[model samples]
Target: MLIPGTHYRLAFTQSVLALLQVINAPTHYRLDYPDLSLILALVRGGSLARASALLKVDVSTVFRAVRRLEAALGQQLFEKSGAGYLPTTLAQTLAEQAERAEQALEAARIGAEQGGEVISGTVRLTCTDSVLQSLLLPALARFMPSYPALTIELCTSNDFANLSRRDADIALRLTRTPPEHLVGRRLADISYRVCASAAYVQSVDSHDLAALTWIAPDDFLPDHPTVAWRRQQLPGVTPSYRCNSMLSVTELVRAGLGVAALPDFLIGDGLQPLTEPLHGYDTALWLLTRPDCRALRSVVTLFDELGLALKLP
Candidate 1:
């Protein structure tokens, strides 16, 4: 009874509406969650070798994990470039989510441990070579025995470690200005003194800093306050030896190569101080940690112990 043309148009309209509805409906895709730890390592380490080292896995394993993640998501998470595997936007988002989840898990673990009698966990601590050798190791030798179950992973480097990235649970830094995001206590001012090998001190006019052959930290430490102070005090005094590391500079001075500015803590039996302890050129030492990490029992215990040890004579 219906007109053929009108009926055809109505059916077509209805079909198009149904198609639109289907298109508008959210598509559900099942994805197998990739290993969150592997992803976090990749994100933080930024290279295959680095990720493998951080995760303590073989490089091929990381590659396979990345491939699996890509396949599961049906999208590339990272792109291979000349520098290394650069994470895509999606990868960054995924990494952020993983970090949040990790934080939540850590919080839960810490809470559960707090309810228990034993305080046990690993705490990663980072500091400069000088601090590690002169101060921290000795302190830990005594402090660690008190907590039988606690484990300490010590990392020594001259470069500033980013605590926010979980590079370390605790960091000891000598800085005039600490980063705003980090929460910590400024322990004390690290004093420095002009020092030379006993032989070198005997040979030169000990009173006249200018008459002595100098050993200075190289351009690697351009912003070092004591180095800058030395430059100002001895104008046009070219160093006989320039070393990249402060420890190397100290060693060179100890070898009677030249006189150099050294931290008070590093003035060993072989070296003699040319000047009394100098203060203004020194930087304040900070015991720093990320805000989220402050709650961890391991971090708190180490932080308190380090603060007390550093304050000691």
Candidate 2:
């Protein structure tokens, strides 16, 4: 029997073909699958850089595609704007049709499972710098050697990558709830604690939290867990150091600059916890990937390996 969405996917495929035929007849200019796919990605992403990331191509390639498609169809598909590339009416319509076609094609590909050794191609994984250094890298070191020909790209950032837009194939995030659109499971409970360098902890009177120097998340990170926790728990106290990145804050703590709230997994080396996990500052570590990407062998392998390795014993 066919997969559950086979009929719906086939219907969309037929509709896209009908739309393409009509578009081609009047202009007598043939646009191939690549051209349409680029258009759809460009429209969805709204910029050359974003489109490039989604398509796994260079920015110049996306720019060149735009120029070529405009020349071929003799229509202005997009207009340059301060924000990014703004799609014109024609581009928007074409993109909608292309998107449906792309979805149908991907569904068919996933259905086939394309039985073969998945020995090549890069899989992009996104996560925070802290996660990269503390957890993911070690797990990857063990898992990557197994797939000799496969390459994995790491995109480290504080912001979540847009998997729906294909910014990355998979993501390892610390969150209470993963996005509904992505498929994944919580690996473990991530706990946080007030931490300081072991030397600093020993030098200072640990019981006197108010007397200790403090480091905190900067103004840019107003929503950071440490920000509110500091304000509420240590009222009227000011931080000596403020960093926008959690990794940077961790480094500052390691240097014995000041005490700061940090994830338990990240508190190692010479760091020591001043308190047990801070209440209301805990979240789970989640391994998430788009539903479409979950079908790919490379993604499946990495996902499974990470799930098995990262889960707390």
In model 2, the worst 10-residue window by lDDT is 103-112
Mind sharing the TM-score for model 2?
Answer: 0.62
Pull out the clashing pairs in model 1: none
Q: Note the Cα lDDT for every prediction shown.
A: 0.75, 0.80
Off by over 4 Å in 1: 1-116
TM-score for each candidate, following the candidate numbering: 0.62, 0.62
lDDT of 2 by residue, 13-90 (tens): 565566565454346676666677788888989999999999999999899989987887877889999989999888
lDDT of 2 at 241: 91
Best by lDDT: 2
